[model samples]
Target: MWFFIQAALYDNNITFSTLGPPKFIDRQEVPNVPLNAPKPVIGLDASTKVATDAFDDLEPEMIYLPLSAYSHYRLRGRSQNYPLLYEYFDINPYSGKLETSRRVSDLSMLEIVTGSMRPLHTGDFVGLSLKLVYFFFGILLSMMIFSGMMIWTKRTYKSTQTLLSRSTKAPSKTTKPEPSV
Candidate 1:
């Protein structure tokens, strides 16, 4: 939950990257991009124009960027107030037109590393490890919940039985006073 909500509650933009350097950053590869290439994928401003490719518009200090948003490449963007996220685009290669863009998030790491263990996606041996991990997680969670409930129920039942037995106990004649009208 913390990791899930942290993206929203906290404006922690991934400024520094440790993945590696971009494919082509040297010599300023000014792409012949469309004016409407840069779109707001996550936190980028809509008014942000392409301005002769995104690489040219970036700050001098900011050069290196990760690859493929769909495959775990998150690059920071320039913003005035809040932290901004960049959407890396795929080029048509032939026509040099922007094909599509995707927001690079941490979840992409899973796909890159394990390729997901959800059985419905990967092969028998490829994602089987992740599938087993998820299965164990579910079993562990169920066991924890069941054990907690059992403990609570036992404590409650014992307490109730003790009180009931005490109340239902037969009283001695001397201790048994006359009933009030």
Candidate 2:
């Protein structure tokens, strides 16, 4: 549990850093940038336009995607109005579009699980490599935990046996043969 929590926090930090500071813009102020523009302004205000170019300036190895909203709704066994909702977003690398409209239950477990490791639509060597690293790391962690538990159980059993043997013998030797009948 501790390891899981730590891993989760670490991933969250990496994601936060990759996305950078949030730059919220009113929907009305958004610029009409062409989808194919080399550097499109994703957000804009009265004074200046914040171009998608800003993301390019980030560390070359960092994986970043623009802000997206995702919604997942499942009726489950409940009434129509009681559906569960989960939200998230992903980017379209080709068109540079932020696709946020999705229902959580509509996605398969694999899609939801792998979404963070790489881009959904595009496959690249770097993304594959990163995913492999994560897979191996999880396996390694599980092995380490199993080995540690085995060691602990072995030591505990040995100590318990030693203690029982000593206790059983100590009483026999310490009690003077009860007064002879």
Global CA lDDT computed for model 2: 0.42
Over 45-163, each residue of candidate 2 has an lDDT whose tens digit, in order, gives: 21011112222221122224434322111111111231222233333332334433234455666444544343322322334676677678779999999999999999999999999
Error of 2 at 117 (Å): 11
Per-model RMSD to reference: 14.6, 16.6
Cα deviation at 57, candidate 2, in Å, is 11
The TM-scores, one per candidate, come to 0.34, 0.31
In angstroms, the error of model 2 at 154 is: 0.4
Across 1-181, the per-residue lDDT of candidate 1 in tens digits comes to 4345445534766322333443432232344456778522322221122312654443211212224322211233432221133334433322233334333343255332332232333223224586687678779999999999999999999999999998889675567677999
Superposed Cα deviation of residue 35, candidate 1 (Å): 23
Model 1: residues >4 Å from true position, as ranges? Answer: 4-7, 10-89, 93-126, 170-181
Give the top-scoring candidate (TM-score): 1
Global CA lDDT of candidate 1, please?
A: 0.42
Clashing pairs in 2: 70-87, 70-88, 72-86, 72-104
lDDT of each candidate versus the true structure = 0.42, 0.42
Query: In terms of TM-score, how similar is model 2 to the real structure?
Result: 0.31
